[model samples]
Target: MYYEDPILKLEDFSLNIGNTKILKNLDLDIYPGEIILLYGPRNSGKSSLLRSFVHLNEELYNNVEGVGGIYFLGKSVFDLDRKYLRSQITYSDPTFVENLNFLTLKEILNLSLGLKLKDISKEYFSILEKLGISKIFSDLDNLKEYNSLKNWSIGEKISLITFISLARRPKVFIFDSILDHLDDFLLEDVKDILYRIKEDRTLIISTRNFSLFSDIAERVVFLDDGKISFAGKTESFIINYPK
Candidate 1:
């Protein structure tokens, strides 16, 4: 059997926030084409671990004291540029979507890709169609006239952000508590979209709603009080950590 190199590695990683130990000695190996479901209760350091990757060059990491480090593709995240690292490892938080209601869907996607809307290729349209949001794009002009996204439900906003993030086709997609806000129908759609796209990228979803994504997750990592309690195949995880 042949094993590919891990796309991301957290070696003895630890995090401290205001004298409280958030993540303690976390060592994880994430490979390409893997959908990892991070399961934990609130304040278990799921969001903190995910945010650390996004703010590799920010004060977030600088302020926190830790000996271990995160490595992307065998390179230390600390050595990479913030923008460059984010482009490869995109992070999305559903709560931030509503704040961006002023921007149209096209504008959001364009800004994510760093290109004008006109320059967007057929691939973008294909992704929208796959995610069942092509109609949203088709009616962009009419929708813009009314500032329609403002009226969208929380689920819709979450899905829109997920779609926009997917449009960028990042090497690693980090989703923080995105599934919790989604309804059953929308959740299934998003799961299907993740399955379709997981072949070419790594997906790290920090969600409390773990059972909903059990079928789609190749591996499950259970975090308890900032420590990884279990990390294994989905079936094994379910068997070991029975509800």
Candidate 2:
């Protein structure tokens, strides 16, 4: 992925749902292989902005109206099929990944990779090793953890999203509510893994606290009251934002 042009671009984008406007004329450009951390307090429209990329807010709101456009790889995302758009621009929230609790490890991978368990077993197992979770999986075998997800750690569940993202290889990964559950140690490890996966993929992370991932994110964007309050390099943001 060369760095001449942005992989994703938003132009004067605005969103309206019934009686209220969620995003107001926001413009942004996301380059290839860039790690972007979007920060804002709750109800600041950070989630809505991310959702607009895949046109997800439309489904959630019946009176949705979008002004302006979002282009992905120079193509209008509006023109693409919903399913294909979602595949290319993967969106995951806290509740989204936690649903893996109902499915086994292999089952989750099967859905993401579109492969049969028998064929994908050995391959995905090696990926698990890279994540340093092979021991957990091996232990789970004894407990038949494959059949139940209740015993799974929250960080482990979140990793399944990362695992699937790695296997499927999407162009963009919009992760919302990722800073809440994971511990500092796991966050550090996940930061390394995220950098690996991001060699060819762009990341858009929604967080309330940017300091937690300040070291990992290359760029930072802040939204306030449905508008962009700040957009700049990570170092610049860190220096300027209130602690």
Candidate 3:
């Protein structure tokens, strides 16, 4: 397959928030069809880096310095239309929790497609059914009515939210600590989805959970205290930073 320019690129990017330097001259590029793992302990500036890429922190946006780039399919994310850029660079954090209240699986899927209020794909639900998750919403009414009034397991909630993410299939997908809360079985399913998406989109996952990335990620970058401590092949990362 002919390759395109970097789907997302960051070079010499640095951020200073409230007198604290969050990122120090970080450089990285993510090509299409690659899955990268960003692993580091809590408060290591992983979230800060994400904010910079997606333009989430308005206050910090002006303070960010460096000749870095954030792109979606060869177009600079900053240069592209904001709403259009958001459609391509989908960032899913723990805060996607609001999606949990979506009730039925179909409703959740519909909600995502409705985000841009774009055209609903006819085959979107078909993908869900193929992934063995369709049964979760076999009964749409009950699923939508499912409430926090009724306690659901973390595993179930994660599974539903993840399926919706896969359904969207953004060009640059970002996940922050998403799989840490999932069980092994569900984690495997999520991995399968990531692998399937590899042929078309780039996956950027940030998590402290290293084992999950050992087999899925081609490159591993370690972040420590707002700096890159290490970057290399996944196997080498495990051999050197064995938990």
lDDT tens per residue, model 3, 127-147:
555445554445545455553
User: What's the lDDT for all of these models?
Assistant: 0.80, 0.80, 0.70
Q: For model 3, which pairs clash?
A: 104-143, 104-144
lDDT per residue as tens, model 1, 1-243: 219989999999998876778899999999999999999988898988888886632354455765598899999988888889888998877657757778765566566666665565688777666655665556657456424567666766786678778877799999888777787877888888888889889999888877788889989999999999998899998877877
lDDT of 2: 0.80
Residue clash pairs of candidate 2 = none
Candidate 3 residue runs with Cα over 4 Å from true position: 1-4, 59-67, 98-111, 115-133, 147-152
- For model 2, residues 1-243, the per-residue Cα lDDT tens digits are 344688899899998989899899989999988999999999999988898889888887799888998899899888988889888888888876568778876666667787654464776777766655666556546436554666777777776676676667789988887645677776777678777778788998899877787888998999999999999898998789885
TM-score of each: 0.89, 0.90, 0.81
Regions more than 4 Å wrong, model 1: 56-62, 102-106, 115-121, 146-148
Query: Which pairs of residues collide in model 1?
Result: none
Q: Name the weakest run of 10 consecutive residues (lDDT summed) in model 2.
A: 139-148
